[model samples]
Target chain A: MIEVNDLTKYYGQKRAISNVSFKVKKGEILGMLGPNAAGKTTAMRILTCYMPPTAGSATVGGYDIFDQSMQVRRITGYLPENPPLYTELTVKDYLMFVAKIKGVEKDKTKAEIDTVIEKASIGEVRNRVIGKLSKGFKQRVGLAQCLLNNPQVVILDEPTVGLDPKQIIEIRELIKNLKGDHTVILSSHILPEVEQTCERVVIISEGEVVAEDTPENLTARMKGGERVLLELEGDEKQVKEVFRTFPDVTAVKVNKTAGGLLKVEVESKKDLRKDYAQALIVKKIGLLEMQSDKVTLEDIFLHLTTKEEAA
Target chain B: MRKTLAIFEKEFKSFFYSPLAYVIIAIFTLITGYLFYNLLSWFVEQSFMMTMQAQQYRQAPPKFNVNLHLIRGYFGTLAFISLFILPTITMRLFAEEKKQGTLELLYTTPITELQVVTGKYLAGLALYIVLLIPTMFFMALLFIYGDPEFLPVLSGYIGLILLGSTFIALGLFISTLTENQIIAAIGGFALSLLLWIIGWGATFTGGTLKPVLEYLSILVHFEDFAQGVIDSTHVAYYLIFTIFGLYLSLKSIESVKWRT
Candidate 1:
């Protein structure tokens, strides 16, 4: 439901984001994965029509953000990094105010607010002043404001950043439930959160898109080779020599751990578990344990974001 | 227009929700009441002195226009008092939104910048009118005890509203430039004071320069309204001044979208 092309934003001479491009399919939950200062918020602001892009174009729900910003704003709900809440207003009042400005029908404004309040699970604190509420409740109110008018696209920036672990999970669940009905573009630096919640992720680094794919596909592409860790009772030198002799073995390192155990790490072009077992049997070495190292989403993110800096 | 009213309703309600609004209104009433009482007592004393002189001379005292001494004098002090009061009313209009980051919510809505500015400006003007409500009772006191011309009193109120609108528009424009409400208040006060006294420059110069400076002084046009003279030129001047202030505010708010 959102399309961005060559989106660039400059605050004075400093480039906040440069030539960024991405798209979110209808009803798809897209995660923008980036570290701090990666231009995620800037890109989201442009899409929400909070600010126009300096040198590119974006359209939301088929309305150009620059020319048809009113139509775009009508269909899009944005929760800025700070939540954009009035501390003096109570939760219900704030949401009702948002609903009004979002142009909800007057007859249905209260019902719409109640629906979002229930969705964000902030019903208990609905009457309390926002300034007095806890951070989690306040964040929920922010989410509640975004869901008003049943917006087609919800753009949230780091919705779970300052929450506790349990609150984080609750927020992630809330976002997950939004899928298949609302087009969500959430930005975060947390890899596992995105991996668990988003169907697709656009990995941004230093104001550029370094990678974009599903979590599994990204991990698969970065897996590169098979790696295994083995614990064996043998001479460390002998263990290294045995693993290195295999033609498929690209590299091998053996270290002697405490309790007279030799720890061996091996990287190979292909799975060498069979070859290692045969070699251990011929050498009469006791194989205590063996397991392959599976590449994780964290590893993939680090590889993609850090590799750009190193280059 | 509906979006503008939504904004206006929220803004107007926000004023009542905060203690600052009540404090400002109370302080305004006390100050204006005290000034009115003092002006009335002084006028009574002057008239008493004139009657004593006439008795001693065995002749009639000169006629004293009650409207000129009491009603016009009270309005003059009120105009001065508003220099301090109006800034407090407008200091938080746009500045608080910027400080609290709520401007993001405002800008992202389907409303134009003009609508937002106009909505806020009207809210401030409405509150100023509400603040002036108590002064009507003070005026009613004049009608019961003395005969004051109705036209001048009505014209003076119109002037006060126009003057308040002008100050509010300027304050709104200044508020958009800063996130600090205190700075906005102080900046607004400084600008209003400058505009209030610009006519003083007319005394130091002659010919073209004097009229140009006089034309810019808000107090100069306000005098015509205070005297029961319904000059269309003065009305047009205040309207144009208000329009100019709103235009500046609109431009400043729009610039924030680009610069931020």
Candidate 2:
């Protein structure tokens, strides 16, 4: 639903984002991962037509960012890092105002406001002034404003920052529920939030996209040969000698425990766990525990960003 | 126009919700009431004394004329009040939006900068009219006491409204230049005071410089307006000034990237 071509932005002498281009299809939940000052916010601003690109072009729903900004704006709902809220306004009034500005018809405005309030789960605080509400409530109100017009593309920047664990979970679930109706592009430094919520991942660093793939593919790409942590009831030397009999075993580290247990870290060129266990069974070496070490989302994110920086 | 009205309603509601609007209105009313009471009492005393002195001299008791002076004095007082009040009201229009990070919300919407500026300007002017209502009571009192010509007083109010609107426009433009509200208020007041002094400064200059200086003077245009004279040139000047200020504000808002 959105196409960007070599979009770049510069602030005076400093380049915030350079040579960035990506496309998001309809019914896709895209996650943007980046470190601090990674130009993620800058890119989102350009996409939402909040700022012009210093070079290149971007279009939302086929309308150019520079030329057809209003058309682009009509279809996009952006929630910036700090929710732009008039604290004096009550939640209901704020949503109503947003609905009007987004050009909702007067007849439908009230019903739409109520729908967003329910969608964001801000029904309780609808009558409360925003300034008096808690940070979590304020964030929900921000999300509600974005959802007011039921825009086709919903862009949320750091949607879960400064929230308690429960509130974070609630927001993540809310985003997940918006899957088919609206295309979602959410940016966050928090790895798991994006990993859990988004269908596709775009890892960015130093104003560049380093990796873009599904979360599973990204983890699988980083996963090379199989590795397993084995704790065995035997001497380290005997465990090492028995492990050597396994053909696919590539590397091993043996640690002897005080209680007659051997902890062996085994790396294999292929799936060798069954073969190693049979060898241990024949050698009478007790296999206490064997857990495969799979890389977590955090590791994938760090590896992608830090590897790009190192390169 | 619907979008403009939506913006206007929001801005107008913002005044009552925030203490700044109420404080400005209350303070303005109090000060205007004080000035009005003192001015009319002063004029009554002057006219009474002038008549008594003429009777003793056996001359036709000097025909007391508070007509022209009353209207002129009201405009003078309004100009001074506007010098301080308009900036406080306008300094927060856009500058506060930037500071509070709400400008991004407005900018990313499907509205143009023209709609935003015009809506805000109209909201401010609406409040100004609310404050002007009490002064009309001062006019009513004058009518009850003496033979007061309604046309000049009506003309004087129109001039005051235009004068206040021009100041508001200038203040709104300054407000967009920076996120600092204090700087906006100070800059707006200083520019207005300079425009007010230009007419008198023209008298100080010799031959060639005088007319050129007078043409730039807001006071020169206001004088004709205050005298019940609806000169098209003077009306055009204030109209152009207002439009020019609004245009500058639009440009300033456009230059800044709205980042939240």
Per-model DockQ against the true two-chain complex: 0.69, 0.52
Tell me the tens digit of each residue's lDDT in model 2 across A6-125: 888888878898888888999799999999899999999999998898888988888998899999999999899999999999999988888888899999998999899999999999
Best model per lDDT: 1
Per-residue lDDT for A1-311 in model 1, tens only? 89999999999888888999988999999999988999999999999989899999989999999999999999998899898898888888888888878889999998999899999999999999999999999899999999899899999999998999999999999999999889999999998999999999999999999988998899889888899999999877778778878888988878888899988889998888989999997998889999999888888888888899999
- For model 2, name the residue pairs that clash: none
The candidate 1 chain A region of ten consecutive residues with least summed lDDT is: A235-244
Please write out the lDDT profile of model 1 over residues B30-83, one tens digit for every residue: 999998889889999999999899989999886888888788878888899998
Question: RMSD in angstroms, candidate 1?
Answer: 2.0
Runs in model 2 deviating more than 4 A are: A230-247, A252-264, A273-290, B258-260
Point to the candidate with the largest DockQ.
1
Provide chain B's TM-score, model 1.
Answer: 0.97
Error of 2 at B128 (Å): 1.1
